[model samples]
Target chain A: MGKKIVLTSGKGGVGKTTVTANLGIALSMLSKKVALVDGDIGLNNLDVVMMVENKIVYDIGDIAEGRCRTKQALIQDDCFPSLFTLPSAKTMDNSRIPPRVFVSIVNELNQDFDYVLIDCPAGIDEGFHRAVAGADEALVVTTPHISAVRDADKVVSLLSTYCMKAVGLVVNRLKGNLVTEGATMDAPDIAKLLRVPLKGAIPEDEEINLSSQISKCKDKSSARLAYLLLASYVDGKDTKVFDCASDYRGFFKKLQRVFR
Target chain B: MLKNNTILRLKRILLSDKVNMPSGLIQLLKKDLLKLFDSYFDIKEESLKIEIDSNADGEYDVSIKGVSERIKSPRFMR
Candidate 1:
């Protein structure tokens, strides 16, 4: 079986889908066969972000219901050969498929792919329960807000109850300027509150939003860099956490400060 | 904003990667305990302290003080 990972957060609109899409792409770029599963059920957006919204004919619900085979539902990415997506059903509600069935599907997919990344739905409801079922690890996504952090704390406590060994955090849509200006919580604050080891922090990048909307890829953007670093870390490569506060300040200025 | 920042910074330093009980939960527990023993004794919510020891063995100790005269009398126990 392959690595089954669930990316989840308790709060909504915190970019869970965005992280799932880009991280799948990033993992594929590292030469791993990746299957991105959209676990949001009725409100699927991973396919849209991957630019394969029009390509999905069969979804996870179809396979779960025995209407189609797993391979029949898998959508191959046009840009990344190693990447595939199991889009969630738009018509079905979150509770239509049982959590046990979702676990079995992930277990089956794990045999074929190197990484099965489940893009979990927001909230601590049935959708979230189904998303994290039978996953090998979890990536708890959160923003720098107090509510998001509190929600993440709840999720982390849940993960602990499930006895999941590997759990890390990814702070998304972080603005360095906001942190420096005292308008936002820093990464350390989030890590402390969430009680998880820090995995990566995705900087607030305008290009990521633009690219997702226009369906045109951009190069070496902040989000891309963050995703790449996250993928490398997941692949067991040693990578430093991106220092948003210092990185926003030019590298030369940071270097000068270090030397001085 | 500066005050908020300072509070956040202090929280980051003091409570990093630690799960402390939320104040709301503490208050709720206090309220429930007060209601349970309201007739026998006066439960002082403000004087109750819940502490978890940091040693190898995970043990929690709850200390409640400020008992009323009725509960303090030796004849009341037996």
Candidate 2:
């Protein structure tokens, strides 16, 4: 059995799905058997983000309700041979899932995969509870915004209450310009506010949205680098914290040399 | 109910912590408050006071006087 990790945020649109998709790809690239479980029932987006929407014949709701076997709901990624997806049902409401059922599902996945990554829906509601029920650890995703940080704090508290073995944070959509201008929160600030160790930070990247929308993950974009670093951390590797300003400087320096 | 121990632990962590309401909730509250008092006042939702400042004396004071145009400054005759 492998570790089960839930990626969650209390606020919506903080890139939980994006993190889950890219992390699955990154882990699979490292030769790990990874499964991304979409826990956002009635509003499934992981499949779309992963560009496997048409391949999903069954979903988590089906398995939870005994409509289909758990294995029957698993969808393999077209791009990565080791990556799989257990998509959430777009038609079913989140209330249909009992906490025990979700836990059982995660335990079953743990038996077959190196990692079971649950992409939780936003809010501290039933979906959030179901997503984290059987996880070995959690990654609380937040943005630089104060509201997102506050919600992330609540999530950290909830995870602590459950006595989860490991709970780290991933701050997504960070703007380097804003951080330098002192107009936005930085990784250290978020870590202090949430009182959790930082897993990784993803800078604001337009390419992430573009690539995901086009179903392409081959781009060596900042978002991809962020995901790779996050996966490396999860796999017990110590990747340095991404310094966005320094990264920009190196990129521009290389560009200038190339042009010269 | 959250247990006494849990509450105490939460108090230790959250004591004197001031959490501002989300912009969405703040907007909704401003709209509701305006609707309730719209007959007598004009209100600016963005300027509305939504935070309660906690003092070292353990007393929290909520200021809502700055939210509306109806609130007038005390006139002083020089």
How far off is each candidate at the interface, as Cα RMSD in Å?
A: 4.9, 13.5
Provide the overall lDDT of each model, using Cα atoms, as 2-decimal numbers.
0.78, 0.77
lDDT tens readout by residue for model 2, B21-66: 3435445766777666565556665555544444667575554554
On TM-score, the leading prediction is 1
Relative to the unseen true structure, what is the C-alpha lDDT of residue A116 in candidate 2, on a scale of 0 to 100?
Answer: 95
CAPRI grade, predicted model 2: incorrect
Error of 2 at A2 (Å): 0.8
The residue-by-residue lDDT of candidate 1 on B1-78, one tens digit each, is 863654444443323335464545545766777776565665576555433222225444444444554553333565
TM-score of chain B of each: 0.45, 0.39
Q: Work out the TM-score per prediction.
A: 0.77, 0.74
Give one digit per residue, the lDDT tens place, for model 2 in A74-193.
988887889899988899866788889889998999999999999998998888888888797999999877667767878887888776889999998888766665556678766865
For candidate 1, what is the DockQ-based docking class? incorrect
lDDT of 1 by residue, A1-260 (tens): 67888999999999899888888888888899999999999999898888888998899999989999999999998878889999999999777799999998898899999999999988888888888886879999998876777678778978887767599999988997777766777776678655688888888878877785212445545567778888988878855676667654767865864564
Give the TM-score (vs. native) of candidate 1. 0.77
Among all candidates shown, the one with the greatest DockQ: 1
Alpha-carbon shift of residue A25 in model 2 (angstroms): 0.9
DockQ of 2: 0.04
Model 1 error, position B31 (Å): 18
